[model samples]
Target chain A: MSITVRIPTVLRSATGGAATISATGSTIGEILAQLASDHPGVQPQLFNEDGTLHKFLNVYVNDDDVRYLGGLQAPVADGDEVTLLPAVAGGFA
Target chain B: MLTLTSEQRDAMVAHCIRNLPNEGCGLLVGSDDGVISQVVPSANVADSARVYEIEPKVLLRTFRAADDSGEVVAGCFHSHTHSDAYPSPTDIAQAPDPSWHYVLVSLRVTPPVLRSYRIVDGDVTEETVTIR
Candidate 1:
């Protein structure tokens, strides 16, 4: 299955400034792994040393957050859109 | 410089006030020239007085809208209920987009204060905000 991954501005450097790219996978995890393989710079940004999704990065497959959709194991169909947005969070702490 | 209409600036301040006790957050949609065309207020899903997270759904919709409209998601704004209009340490650490204009609104005083900055590689540099 081919999926479209929308890269956020922060991660553009990893994709050579491309805002969106296409990768093939049947699951979110596989697609992300393919992305990391294609763009080594994105591996550290998307995953932690233990291979878990970065806590602050939000990944959505077709408008629904993957965290609520079985995380990276979430199934995806061909043409599914994946979006990566870093958590826009901060405070006066 | 970040250019906003007077109404857009006021809308941001009003949204922050409405979400009192918790930080208010929103996305800025604009053209490539840094002139904001829309001030999209969103629920601070974090729901904390000390922190904020723009609702993910809102963000997705905004990105789609901007793409459809040939605009861009320029940046975002958040209100600081107790501190000055500056990016806190946590803000610096969580700065998501280096190209984005991080706008902070300080409500520590009676009248809110708004400031814009470009946070690149953990460095914060204030930018001029022109309200027309």
Candidate 2:
């Protein structure tokens, strides 16, 4: 299945400054794996040494967080759009 | 540049001040060009003077309201109880959208200082704020 992956600005360098890219996979995990293979620079930013998604990054499929939809195992199909967001820590005293 | 009306600016400051010792958080809604149409104040679940978390339910409701009004989530605003009106390291790391205008309100001064910023790829750049 083909889908659109929205790359956050922090990871745009890996995609040669392209804000969005197309990938093919039956599941979210597979699509991410393909992205990593295509843009090696983004692999470290998205995945940990243990291959798990970084805790700080939040993935959403069509606006709904993936954490609520089975995480990396979430299913995907043609035309699906995935967005990545990083958790912020501010308001420090 | 981000434009905010005087009332809008005051609303933000009031929300932050009302929270007092606890940090306040909210989302800004408007056009993508940095025109703030609304300041949707939200609950700070963190309940800490040094931290904040926008209540999810409030966020969802605000988002829906903005959607219905044809406004986008232009950016976010939060208060720094004792720090300067600037984007902290954690704010830089968590900026999800490069297009957003991150507004920081510091209550440390007698007259709270408000600042606007844009965070892209961990780079923090101050934006012009026009309060009319």
DockQ in order: 0.84, 0.28
Give the clash count for each candidate. 0, 0
Model 2 DockQ class: acceptable
User: How high is the TM-score of chain A in model 2?
Assistant: 0.91
List TM-score per model, in order: 0.96, 0.71
Local lDDT at A78 for model 2: 93
Fnat of candidate 2: 0.42
Scored against the true structure, residue B32 in model 2 reaches a CA lDDT of: 76
In DockQ terms, which candidate is top?
A: 1
Best by TM-score: 1
Worst 10 residues of 2 chain B by lDDT: B55-64
